[model samples]
Target chain A: DAGVTQSPTHLIKTRGQQVTLRCSPKSGHDTVSWYQQALGQGPQFIFQYYEEEERQRGNFPDRFSGHQFPNYSSELNVNALLLGDSALYLCASSRGQGSEKLFFGSGTQLSVL
Target chain B: GIQVEQSPPDLILQEGANSTLRCNFSDSVNNLQWFHQNPWGQLINLFYIPSGTKQNGRLSATTVATERYSLLYISSSQTTDSGVYFCAVEEYSSASKIIFGSGTRLSIRP
Candidate 1:
């Protein structure tokens, strides 16, 4: 079976522009979570979605939001991107909304100019 | 908020050498996972160890949940093992959020 998939693999945007990254969870998974990984750092939790609603969020600003569809796919949106937003966006999916085993995607590299 | 700290922030070893990485969490967690991010930036799942020991090939991990610490042992490391290893945990109060440590960068030279 195909693992978690994310697209576009890389992206470029300017300050004040809005960007949306997409993710498709692995088969038989029902929860999707987003994370940000800056250079030289570990992945930071952005938020998690289950049942098409946001169940939990991290300490991120309001400008960062996400959505989960009926099919368990997810999208992470960053409004008014900042240069500091340039990082690798990772998407992980699990069987449920608890602390379960996770399957991660290759991640999308966003570069804000 | 719970804290996850990984140590030996950096390590370099020759092929066939052995190494150990430690992860310490601030509180009790329901789940703990280990990931190896390759040079190509893929987060490969290494272990999903919550409170016991599991072995996979030459790699093994042990999580002492009572002590809130975990250790990853890599035996006979290979050049392909060069990457960053991260420890992530999901605590009871955090819902389903997983917090990751800064990671240990391992470079296995051939």
Candidate 2:
């Protein structure tokens, strides 16, 4: 069985531009969550998608958004990216929204230059 | 918002050493997990221990929900075990959100 997979292992974007990162959850899982890990810091929750809708969000602003498809894949979009947006974006999948176990992907490294 | 704190932010040890990482949360938790972030920045799920103790090979974790704390023990560490260990907790009242601790960086030298 395949674990969580993310696209574009590394990316480079300029300020004011928007970028979309893709994620395919682990097989047999339905919930997807996104996190941002800045240099020298722990991963911070960005938001969670369940049932094709965003169920919960963290302290992030409106610039960060996400979507979940019927197939349980997810996409994280960041608009008007700033230099600080550079970080490692992680995607975690679980059997359900409330499932205690979370399987994470290798993550997409976003470099805002 | 719940606060999560980890102790011994950085540690260095020789191979075959044993180490313990601690995590403390400010509120009751319904779910707790430990992750090891590799050198390449991949978060590897270590354990999903909400309560009690669970052991997996050289790694073991114990969570006391009532005390709002968790401990991760690594025995006979290897250089491959070098990484940052993080503790994430989700409150029972909130099912879709998780708070993560700063993490403990462990470096095992051969």
Please report the candidate that would top TM-score against the real structure.
1
Candidate 2's C-alpha runs over 4 A off are none
Query: In order, what fnat does every candidate score?
Result: 0.89, 0.83
Task: For candidate 2, write residues A34-80 as lDDT tens digits.
Answer: 99999999999999999999998999999999899899999999999
lDDT tens digits by residue: candidate 1, B1-110: 99999999999999999999999999989889999999999999999999899999999999999999999999999999999999999977876989999999999989
Q: Could you tell me how far off, in angstroms, the CA of residue B67 lies in candidate 1 after the best superposition?
A: 0.7
Reference-based lDDT, each prediction: 0.95, 0.94
Q: What is the lDDT of residue A99 in candidate 1?
A: 71
Q: lDDT tens digits, residues B1-110, model 2?
A: 89999999999999999999999999888889999999988888999999999999999999999898999999999999999999999867777798899999999999
Worst lDDT run of 10 residues, candidate 2 chain B, spans B90-99
Per-prediction DockQ: 0.89, 0.85
Model 2: how far residue B95 lies from native, Å: 1.6
